[model samples]
Target chain A: MAGEPVATSAAPVQPGAVLLRPPTNPVDRRAVGWWTVNLLIGFAVPVVVLVVLGLLITPARFWLFTPAVVIAFAGLAAVLALPRWWFRVHRWEVTDTAVYTRTGRFWQEWRVAPLSRIQTVDTRRGPLEQRFGLATVVVTTASAKGAVTMPGLARDVAEEIAERLTVTTQAIPGDAT
Target chain B: MNGDWRRLDKRAVPVAAVTMVGVAFLAGVPSAIGLSGISVGVALAWVLPGAVVVIAAGAGAAWLDWRFTRYQVGAERVEVRSGVLIRNRRSLQRDRIRTVDVTADPLQRVFGVVTVRIGTGEHSKGGTVQLRPVARATGDELRRVLLARVSTSVPADGRLATFDLGWIRYAPLSFLAPALGAAAVGGLFNVADWFGRVEGLVGWAIDLLAGLGLIGAIAVLVAVTLLIGTIGALGFWIEMWWAYRLDREAGGTLRVRRGLFTTRSISVEEERLRGVDVVEALGTRLAGAARVDAVATGLPTTVEDNKADQRTLLPAVPRALADRVAADVLREEVSPTAAVVLSPHPIAARGRRVRWALATVLAGELPLIVLGVLLTEVLLHVAWITAALALPIALVLAVDAYRSLGHGRVGGYLVTRSGTIRRSTVALQRRGIIGWTVRQSAFQRRAGLATVWATTAAGAGAYAIRDVGAETGLAAADAAVPGLLTPFLAPLPDSRPVTDETVAESTAAGEA
Candidate 1:
């Protein structure tokens, strides 16, 4: 909060189109490590299977070897670069009135959902995320596509955010539609 | 509650049993002929006794079901209790009920009973309750009670639109006509197979084709198909909309009652209506005809296979009339779909479309070319010929799709028009939009384009403005819903002092 310029709902809202700012906070540092490990595991299984088939099947060895080599290189590149790339890209911010998030690697999306329209807030901790001491928070509005997900946060931070969202959403008045 | 519990009509037992017998009889015809081809003794012995046993079993089941099934219209809720092996209780809050639909098939009509389907605004399994084969009077009473809250002194006759036989002209112009025609041909072959005369039928068709020259045979076949298709389309239209009536009742419910053999009365509460979708498929569009569908919330599907949705307020009428009726439904002076000045997509959108169209052609051609190289000289010729013929058609379609892309704000609705073959212009309530999703692909980023989708709770969930200019997309979203996107937005960097002027609305157009 000291270094980041946290937006306050009390700020006067101007009426015209303005450049949508990035969210203030980055996810936990351990999340990058978690993603790298997961990416390695994800890319390893396919390469292993291809290599096994290549070894067993003599006629298709050439075809399977090419794919296995290609996959291994692709996986290596993604593991080395993508997790760090996404760590810089993905950010989330919550003000009294709205929750804003910036996400996606090649195709970015910045979503803003008003607190008054939020219907439910939930926090989840998967096994890997738990190992990394991280959690994901999801806020859904009545609209089908209006789900705001902020993943790779410290567990306590995710819970606190969820709690704040729930309290604020309840305090605001609307059918959430 | 016990004293108020009412059993379904007693006569429903016979109706159900008889309906089963009728279905068996109709279905048995083909099987019987096929069986008799093997052995007359086998056919006679099996179908007769099988049918009798089925009738007895159906009667027993129907009787037991009737005896156990009871419904109660309580003060706060409506409950139905049924099932033999495992008793079940289903109830819906009276206040939550959004629609009360009454339908009667030919058999049920004869028995003076109708199936009452109660629906909520949710698309969940428990969102509907069915009271099968209730007395017609009971069904009507339930509908009146469930839908009509207060009987005001002002009786809103509520009749907004009625069936026009002249609209039958548009029947043959629908995309359904050709499909129905092809289906009829398939159905004939199926029937022939059932009768073990498929070979004979094929021989007859070949003889007819052979007698005519090649061109003549093709022409004759096309003519026959068109004739059958036209007749099928007309018949289907009649069956679906013979006595169609759209009325706005005094209690603020829009009631649509239609169908010939199977009568249906579907009521929609006005409060749930978000907007309307005016559809114009290519065939109908060329003929100056269009259909209007209620873009309301809670257009729920019941357990019955009503795959054909129940949203049509006016089916393929004059464009002028359709627009007027859509306006009427939305309680607006002019329909936003027609009235709005839609901002067309940029010239780059056309380029994008052309590139996509060519890519599509290449995708198809690649497989053909590969096969042609691997197989024979004939396939090579075929591949090149197909490429030559398909290229122009694909380009034309792509150009049409480009022309169809537009979005606008008019009245209280945000209107979006898209698609070439089936161009639909949806006028959704601006307030109904709960959120906006702005998307840009890597290619789109290079082209300075973005697709912005307005997400809502009603009707298809989201409507997108495809390939809009990046700044324009953000500006539109920002303007449409004031303050929703304001806090997140930052003014353009060091350009100039801006008023209400739209500006590259990028605060964090990050490395992504």
Candidate 2:
């Protein structure tokens, strides 16, 4: 679609019923490995900067190692359990009518968006995701806050999901708002 | 295709120069006063060179900017180019276009021109292209052509609402009065400080109030500030809403036109309007008045420009009138926010509010109390006195807020009301709710309370029912949009008795 992605008139909506339950499908297990690496890098950078500064400047020694040790402990704990915990928490499922997603580790969030409201569907692959041969599918609705991201799917699976969503969305009418 | 570039209206230079000069005069008052010390001839001689440089630079820059600024609607994208030495170009994809709005201020109206803004409805500033001060006919033609696909020519009735001189009664009731008063005082203090005379001004004020005791002086000061605020608020309201009118155009658009010195006409395509927000600030609520705001998708975001409230359709008026207007805007028999029987949040929500309020007060009090003990007895006294004064007010507000918390639905709308200081009751079309976000923090989980947000592309982006009982939030969300949540919820087929059209209305009919 270019220049003018003409939206057809609003088709009647089939008012479907929804229940409040956790999502059904868990993402690829490779996501766990990806998270572990991603988290380790996130924690290591700050500690590295502190250690370098601590060695270079005598004055920084008073505060550097203490923070470095704390970060190290936190990083160690995160690297060990966070991946598995997130893998268990992050789940999603796409149906003919809507998309259901559960994200966030501690403060749980459950989101459900009807397909009629979906504006766009695309697959994103960062370098890290490419390294793991995994891709993430991003679905955006008209609402600024209504973007759902499901990470850690096999690259091919992510592409298929995005393709299916886009096809389904195109058939529905209105501005997908 | 790359089309021929178009320059902004030449009048843009005069507009920019006038505004810049006004700002310069306001900012240069202190320097102007300092210049008074010198003889007029000497001051003129000293200021001539600097003034010449500044005026020339400012005029030359404005002219160059106006000359360089160009906008074009190409085959696939709309682009704008501007700037002098630091040239900049921005473009928005045509396919991504979500809104094309035309607005004309009094200045532009005088020149028979308007501002055309095209956007992708994204939150980022770059998602939009603003073509300021284009010919009025061109702006209208652009809006018509850009949105031609969706236009439906339904012969509209006359105005939905018109400005009444009586509405000014509610003007003084706006909470902006006290806030504006305080802001004025703050400005005065800043101005005094600029002259290094803040202490002297404070001394003079103290001297003036010496006749009264400490409590009397404070009461007098507060009363005076509120009085000033009321006048300022009234003047501002009149200036902003002097000739307000809400109308539905023949081309399936709901248009709002208002403002005195600076007039604005903002139109929302009826198709994009998902709902209405009925706002009643504490003052207005107590006075039995409310304002109506259109909850339409793709309106310009206010975060980038703190200036126009493009969503407001009606100013503070009688609640009944606001409801009537809300109904008219939605094409409903009666507003859902009015007809629905709202279910109040659990009593625990009340307790939570009280606890949060007192906790906040204690946080401030404890720090002061500790500092006072370490520093002086006077501070300790002041801390306890402040706590004593604040506690009851906080508790009352918390209780009122708890009472205000409610959610309900009527017809095809989900009506939810929350907030105390600015209580807003929103009647969002059930179909407009494209998504749901259910959140439960650990403490909220313990309380069996959850916050459910009906996320849509309209007004606030998401309207939330806060601190509702867990089942209440779930049932509301589930009932609001039937099948989407079924797989996630436990198999409670009869969770809620078949209410409304949930099961019966399997037909695919869009909005009424």
Candidate 3:
């Protein structure tokens, strides 16, 4: 007896598929600027402290601490700068069976979660983000602390993603895992 | 229902008047004391100002009583129309009420008057609609009507149970022995002087008592300890008796009625409950009694004021009944959730243990150090050895954290157990999480660790699992909710936008 064709209706979305693009609004640009400003402001305190120490301490001790301070600042700046590039490079695809995210510059990190496992989708905006009309969407899964944040999206885009995710997640059975 | 609602007992008026007078008298006591330390004219000045304010306040209270003393309750609602000139009218809807509390002070009891308070979940200037000094019979009828209305609104599937504390459940004798010993030692310091005062008349009697056989002394000591314990137990029993009723009504409404002089009742809807916490205090743990509290959303904000209301639920219950009662009242499968073990990182847990042990060693050696300084001797050597002894205690604590550090899931719920002397076990469902965060510090990043905090709308803040491996934490978050990582991955389709008319219609429907 011949076996029947395997069902492909619930197959995972293709990794290279582009589901949708974020809204091209001035608000999105402002949100990026606001985050940049916050990062700069946070850096100011350490900079002030180091300057004061350099002025008060001896030259030899100052030189000893200066490299460590510069390294620390550079590390912080790198973490802050990486988000912009990550957002630009990131793309998502969704099908009946799975949701996948592909993001990277030199080395890519691709995460594919079956729609059955999708639990909740939440969107939030701080005061600065609100002023810039941008939102951050967070998707949480079953595993502890298993979440990813997507920022710099317009308000309407965030709402649409929330609706689609809710529908797709609800339609799948055995997704609670 | 149409029967007359009698006014508060007339004698309550006199008792209130006496209380007011006493307050006024006490208000002047400090000024009167100050008067004796100053010149005659200055003393008069100090006394006059306070006396004037007290007199004015008393007169104003009396005027308020004369104008708006009477309050009435009907089958549908309670009305308290009071105020001298402004005429403040407050009406409480009987259907909106969650519980009715009736209390009576010693004087009010004698006068056959009761203070009736009707509590509702309405948010306004008047948190509780209160009518003080109503007649005992009227108070009872009012309570019945309010309870009847509230009971109708509750769903039919809930259960009602009453609990009592017996003498056996009284805390074990071991817990109070230390306190009694301390009290007796302190009492010895005062007894010698008392014996001296009556030396001539009862000198022989006092000597006989002091010279009593060791057995007699032991018997007397045992009697005193038992008496104190009995008194404490009686107080606890009385409180338990007064606040013992629990009502589980249909539609998932759970009502807990409790309190002594000021009876407080709380009604919680089933859908709003987030979790239940079973806490055992160090003393209670020794006695094998654990207190249980059901956690819910929209808990009264007043519960946060630790001083005024420490209880998030009713009084503490025995451990045996905690799980059973939670299941019966909440109608949810109750089990142990996650176990919150202390972080076992050497730098964090072991470091704290080392510090504690060192402090203990220092404490033990402090007296010798002081004596050495005074005697100019070699007790300093002993202090050095005492410091070394702390190492073992640090090692023990670090080992304990490692052994105790474990967590697991029970069915669909999570149970977290932690603490050494005072242990806590919290049980919560997976869907109860309102939100969560995964945070990493520079140090934690280097160590491949992160802190995951899950927030619910239940208590004042969030519940957290700290310093877990970053990969494990991420996995746990995914298990908690899969798609929470990217809520806005795909853009939303354009639709008919929200308008003023739609907003108005929704608001109108919500109000209805």
Please give the TM-score that candidate 3 achieves against the real structure.
Answer: 0.53
Looking at candidate 1 chain B, the ten consecutive residues that score lowest on lDDT are B497-506
Descending-lDDT candidate ranking:
1, 2, 3
Tens-place lDDT per residue, model 1, B422-499, is 888999998888877777776676565678888787766678889886666777787788778777666644223121
**Tens digit of per-residue lDDT, candidate 3, span B141-204:** 7766666543355556634556565523544333444565556545654454444434553465
- Summing lDDT over every window of 10 consecutive residues in candidate 2 chain A, give the lowest-scoring window: A1-10
Candidate with best TM-score = 1
- State the displacement of the C-alpha of residue B494, model 2, in Å, after optimal TM-score superposition: 14
User: Could you give the DockQ of candidate 2?
Assistant: 0.28
Best by DockQ: 1
Candidate 2 per-residue C-alpha lDDT over B315-391 given as tens digits, one digit per residue, 9 for 90 to 100: 99999999999999999898887999999987778888999999989998997889888998998899989999999
TM-score, every prediction: 0.89, 0.86, 0.53
- CA lDDT of B311 in candidate 1? 78
Per-residue error (Å), model 3, residue B350: 7.4
Q: Which of 2 and 3 is the better model by lDDT?
A: 2
